[model samples]
Target chain A: MEQLVSALLIMIIGVLACAAYFYASNWLLDVLFPSKNKPADIVAKNIHITNTVRPWLFIGPALIALTFYLIYPVIESIRLSFLGRAGEEFVGFDNYAWLFSSDTFYQSFKNNMLWLIVVPTASTFFGLIIATMTDKIWWGNIAKSLIFMPMAISFIGASVIWKFIYDFRSGDDAQIGLLNAIVVFFGGEPQAWITVPFWNNLFLMIILIWIQTGFAMVILSAALRGIPSETIEAAVLDGANSIQIFFKIMVPQIWGTIAVVWTTITILVLKVFDIVLAMTNGQWGTQVLANEMFDWMFRGGGDFGRGAVVAIVIMVLVIPIMVWNIKDVNKEMEGR
Target chain B: MMAVSSSRSSLMWVVHITVFILVVMWTVPTAGLFISSIRDKDQLSVSGWWTALSVSEQRLVARSEHPDKQVFSSDGRYEIRGNILEHQDSSITKFGSSSLRPDEFDVGVVAQLKGGKTLQVLENGDYIYSSPEQWKGKRGKRIFYTANIPPRFTLDNYREVLTSEGLAKSFINSLAVTIPATIIPILMAAFAAYALAWMKFPGRALIIAAVVGLLVVPLQMSLIPLLKTYNLIGEFFGVGSKGYIGIWLAHTGFGLPLAIYLLRNYIAGLPGEIIESARVDGANDFEIFSKIILPLSFPALASFAIFQFLWVWNDLLIAMVFLGNNEEQLVLTGRLRELLGSRGGNWEILTASAFVTIIIPLCVFFGLQRYLVRGLLSGSVK
Candidate 1:
């Protein structure tokens, strides 16, 4: 009975909210985006004052959220990095020295390098190949949907699925792990997959590749579709073969789209944590900068100082790429 | 007659073939998973799901009734009858004791039973006992019969995983995270996007740049710092950091930059003339945004919402960092991860949970699928 009443009340609130939004939106449109008729000077003065206040109402939440969430934490991180757990004892360079001098930090840095180098490139390359192939075809939409399915899956979700594929177990007499099962069927010895230090990283890389390849495919495919048919025809008529036309004409035309996909995946690769966490939990040298930072801050034996340094280092790498991405996007906008 | 067109067409076919292969390669594992998830657990454990169409061979023992249950009749016949399934080798038609001798036994075999009674069994479970005359004892001894049970399909796995496994609860928790996370950003991004898109303001460029800067700063970097800020702020407000609000705010923080970026581009692509005319007609910025910008920018709003919704819904790290690991507070992705580690062998639960997790994202994606394909910047381009 109580549940029924609350349901009723909730519905009433929802209806009321919608009605208010509707009426307010109508009034708002009438005021802010009135018909193109020129207004009187007196009315214009009021409109200008309201307009000044209006943008704040529009953007105010973002500012508040950003200040508290992004900006404040950033400042606090810097400060906390200089302090100990109590956040009172100031140990300025100790955090920096500890992170830099430690083997864990070096390993994390190396993993980050591998991630930065491999994920984006592999993803983009596969995306381009698929894009070029799937530009216009009978089954193109279906094909695209298949590839793009992983993007719908979350990072954690992808990690879980991949774990089964990479499921490793000890002892031959025990249950056959998935990967080992396949290998042994082919008359190969059961390898301790994750225990193989260097190759295990590649095994880890496959998950990211599986996920990002779809994203790259979609964006790059769109770009490929956007390329003008006339340009391709002209290139072919000018004595170019398929490969040459692809490399020369198609590449130049779709560079903008390629840039968009490359940067997007690059940004994603830098923040990667779940795959490593889910698969190996950063054990056996799979830990990257983000996971390491997480380790430093959240775990029981956490170091505030080291966590902050890693955070700052990640920021340093990302900001420049982002700036470049924005500039490219803005330039593309201006060119249009 | 059409050599040039024919060759060109062939080239297109070549491209089509290549694309088709890539798509098939991509979908194989998911298909395998889908097949494995639905099959019987016993079958799933033993063989790859790809073999679901084929019949499976299993072995079991058919045992005769116990010696104590048999009795001699007046006509010199012994009788023993009961559920034969309990017997170790009751009514054996063909019997190979061990898996190493899988092919040794043949059908319609005669084996000598205790007390010199001869029992003949057919390939089927039908057993014939030759006795002297009238049967004595209550019933025949229990015999075990073995048959190749054909492949069985069921929804029981889904039921078990969804109800007993707490998947329904996790599904709800996922929605709780996703809906708010999606809505908050879209609502905020709509306003911010309109302002950046149309409304001229001081420090707009800087904020937009800052947003772009935030985009690149790797969420891993901010996750810790952000958690610290939340704990401190929570202490002041006396609100626990381990609640829905903290994680929502965290997701909101993470989702904002991309939301703002995607949305601003879309809103900016709307007809400037309409906005300008509205401004000239004495309308305020908020009014213009709420009515014109929001409606026209729906497609972009939708696309960005899908992206944000999916990201937050699927998010495990931020949820782990902010939301407590307790079952009630745990997000679907986090719960799924925990389940994967603990019940890695349970394909049914895993797939059903996976399907449930995807339901929202898929709905959001398909609901706004058109926008997903749209490059809102096409307007700016034109």
Candidate 2:
């Protein structure tokens, strides 16, 4: 309780301090210029000076934060990837060599590739299908909300939920887990889902897909709504069936939104960590790049070189999607 | 029209059935967790939550009253009469006097016992034992029964987790981290977004492009370098590297690009006449921003607030890196992950803790769903 009180105090003070900086800086600018009582010539000069200075004032804090947090780190991480474990000695290409030979790294790379292939495609497909289906029903909004609900759950929490479902109990004791119970009811042997090699990665991917499908659905649902009714009506007049209209008239127009959803999920998959950390901590062949990087960070009391390499690996995987996103935004800006 | 109507009905039915199945599949997992969290812990491990409303068959053993409680009837017979479920709350479906055959006798039937004694067990748990001789024993006879127990629910699991598991403290920590992290980014990003949208600057286009590009740079790239920098700065300042302030700044920095991009797009599309009129009225840029633009951009501000709030509240990796794992600073997600490790098999604790961790976000998601969907549509669908 004392901690909670202190936390609230800190929050209030921090917020107030931020507001004060903006307010105080603006006030100081006004005081220094004092355009209220000056002559017309001096007032015009003051206004021009403030206009030039104010834009920087507005953008200065954001710029400082971005450079300090993101830009500097990207450069530093690249440099650190070439350094030794303690970062006191210079090493060239050795960490990459080690990464290539390590079995766990290989497994992580393989599993991440599987995730990259499966999660985005599955999420986007399910999202598009559900969005299209729900748009026609009366309780569409409720159904959409139910399916979208998983987005609010944290990855760790989702892991616990899925882990419970995949729980395996041995012997004649009735299966407590939902999956095992169904398997037992059908006279099949229950398996430990997360411990299975090669296939466990897909089981882990299912959690992410469950959580992200809603994001795709929400975006695509809007895009689906944005399609012009005239196209559908024209298709109808030509005696096009529902499937034909949906595939030919509707999907082709929403391809851009689909690409956006797919790329977004792909980027997210590259940074997947908490689910793996909570579920298996990369044990039993379920290792992914993000969790592997995290393990290297704390393994044997921290190894910055190997960890930075893994981070760079993740960044490399994400660069294509990042480039694609920037180009899409630039195109939109040009159109605007 | 007639043919179209006929086929459309069939299509609609198919849509309804398919959607219903999908909805059930999606909702049942969460519903199972929720139901299991409130259930009797013993019952939870034995049955699925879908059967939570039905009667569950359980094997139980009950001891009858001690032989000392026997009474002498006027007919000179020693008898013992008592309820088999004296303190329990279940109906007996079958009863037996032996362990091997627990359900040997049907309820309300008399069973012949040793030495010509008779025992009767009833559905309501009442039992009678009579013999034509004095009863002398220290303990009563053990009776085995098969019971059809009704569904039971309790708030004890929630209480246990909240009181003993430290989730309540973590809940506050999450709020502390989330509120400032959510608010600071909005303030910083709104100003930058306003400048990018309305002001004339030489490098405005480049800055806008940078913000969009940074939107997808994997956060993994930032963690290592930032950790080193933070350690150095903390050592120089003689303070710990992990604290609420550091995390708030980290989240603000990470969240800024999206916040700025989303808010910039919204602000730039606003009618230019409002700012122009304010300018013509001799108001300066600051005046126009706080007074005119801020009020006009409430919807955008609200939408971004919900997104940032949810993201920060749901984040675990950032918390683990930037904040300490002690009780004073562990956020809900961190606490939950710890619980997953320490209390892995105890679903009673796990379910309740997981439910507590997610309940706030679920509420926020349902409550502000309009703004959330609107934000997603504008932020990505463009």
- Tell me, by lDDT, which candidate is best: 2
Per-prediction DockQ: 0.41, 0.80
Residues A230-257 of candidate 1 have per-residue lDDT tens digits of 9989987788988998899888987867
The interface RMSD for candidate 2 is 1.0
Which regions of candidate 1 deviate over 4 angstroms? A1-48, A168-182, A326-336, B1-16, B59-104, B107-147, B375-382
**Fnat: each model in turn:** 0.48, 0.81
lDDT per residue for candidate 1 within B26-138, as digits (tens), equals: 77655665666677776666555656776655455544555465667566776554333332332333543334553354646765555566555565455555455444555
Each candidate's lDDT (Cα)? 0.70, 0.91
lDDT of 2 by residue, B176-203 (tens): 9999999999999999999999999889
Clashing pairs in 2: none
- Give the CAPRI class of candidate 2: high
Candidate 2 segments whose C-alpha is farther than 4 A from its true place: A334-336, B1-4, B61-87, B94-144
